[model samples]
Target: MTIKLLAIGKTDHTDLQSLIDDYQKRLGFYVKFEFEIIPDLKKTKNLSEDQQKQKEGELILGKLNSTDVMIVLDENGKQLDSVNFSQYLQKHMNSGIKQLVFVIGGPYGFSPEVYQKANGKLSLSKMTFSHQMIRLFMIEQLYRGFTILKNEPYHHR
Candidate 1:
């Protein structure tokens, strides 16, 4: 399956962008991967948290196709170890899906509509992480998962 990571806003830090780029390149060797950045909402200061989430949810949902399997990254979601995450990826690939979409929502998190649309939710850690940094971390974990699947030396037990 083609894997796509959709995140709101562009990463402003050069260091984090470099790391994300590296992992994206490495992931290409294993699977079809795409990173799409949805531009941040404008004048969000005027809107309530719920309103902002609603707007962002519309944008997030707009990117998806009916057949795409949507997965949202949320703080309260299920956390998996590296091995199990690899197995998770394998499970999706074996399911014959055309695209598997993983989304990192805005500052206030996903709206109820977005959450409802997702096939599943995953959490990287219990501790909070910045939206920009999470992109790098997520890509690295994806790279690691693929390496584990390929019996490559990138991940060590």
Candidate 2:
């Protein structure tokens, strides 16, 4: 199965992008991983929070194929540790799905429509994180999860 990460906006910080790239390369050894950035909405200062979410939701939903299983990275979603997350990845692989898409929404978070289309929701932490930082965190976790699954020395546990 292919694991895809879709997030809103590009990472402006070079340091963060470099780290994300490194993990992405490491992940390629274990699985086909794709990181896609959805461009930020224009004239956001003119739109209301709900309006922005609605527009962003459209862009997010447009990226998916009919068979893709979308899981949104939501603040109120389920949180799992590295080991459990590895098992979660294993479960999805065993289920024989084509693509597993995890989305990171814009500033106001996902819209009702986006939430409704999601197969599941996952949270990296109870505390909030910047969208750019979340990209790195998510990618690094994916790499860590694969290492755990392979019994690699990368993960201490």
Candidate 3:
């Protein structure tokens, strides 16, 4: 299955960008991977939390294709270890999905529509992490999962 990461706004850290790029390139060898950025809303001070979420939800849902299997990277979502995460990837591939989309929502998190569209949710960690940092972490985990699947030296138990 082709894997896609849909996150709100661009990452400002050049260092993080390079690291994410490195893992993305490495992951290409195992499976198709793509990262798409949804531009941040211009003004939010006047908007209610619900309104902000609704607007961003529209943009997030717009990126999806009907056949896509969406998974959200949510704080309260199911958390899995490296081996388990790799197994999860294998299971999705076995299911014959066209695309596996994982969304990292905006600052306030996902709206009802976005939540409804999601097939499942995954938590990388119990501790909170900055959205910018999550990009690097997600890509690195993806790379690690692939290496584990392939029995490569890139990752060890």
Residue range 1-157, candidate 2, lDDT tens digits: 9999999999999999999999999999999999999999999999999999999999999999999999999999999999999999999999999999999999999999999999999999999999999999999999999999999999995
Q: Which has the better lDDT: candidate 2, or candidate 3?
A: 2
**Model 1 Cα lDDT, one tens digit per residue, 10-126:** 999998899999999989999999999999999988999999999999999999999999999999999999989999999999999999999999999999999999999999999
Q: Which clashing pairs does model 2 show?
A: none
Q: Which stretches of candidate 1 lie over 4 Å from their true place?
A: none
The candidate, 1 or 3, that scores higher on TM-score is 1
Give TM-scores for every candidate, taking all chains together and pairing residue i with residue i.
0.98, 0.98, 0.97
Model 3 poorest 10 in a row by lDDT: 148-157
1-157: candidate 3 lDDT, tens digit per residue: 7999999999998988998888889999999999999999988999999999999999999999999999999999999999999999999999999999999999899999999989999999999999989998998998899899999988864
lDDT, residue 103, candidate 2: 99
Tell me the number of clashing residue pairs for each predicted model: 0, 0, 0
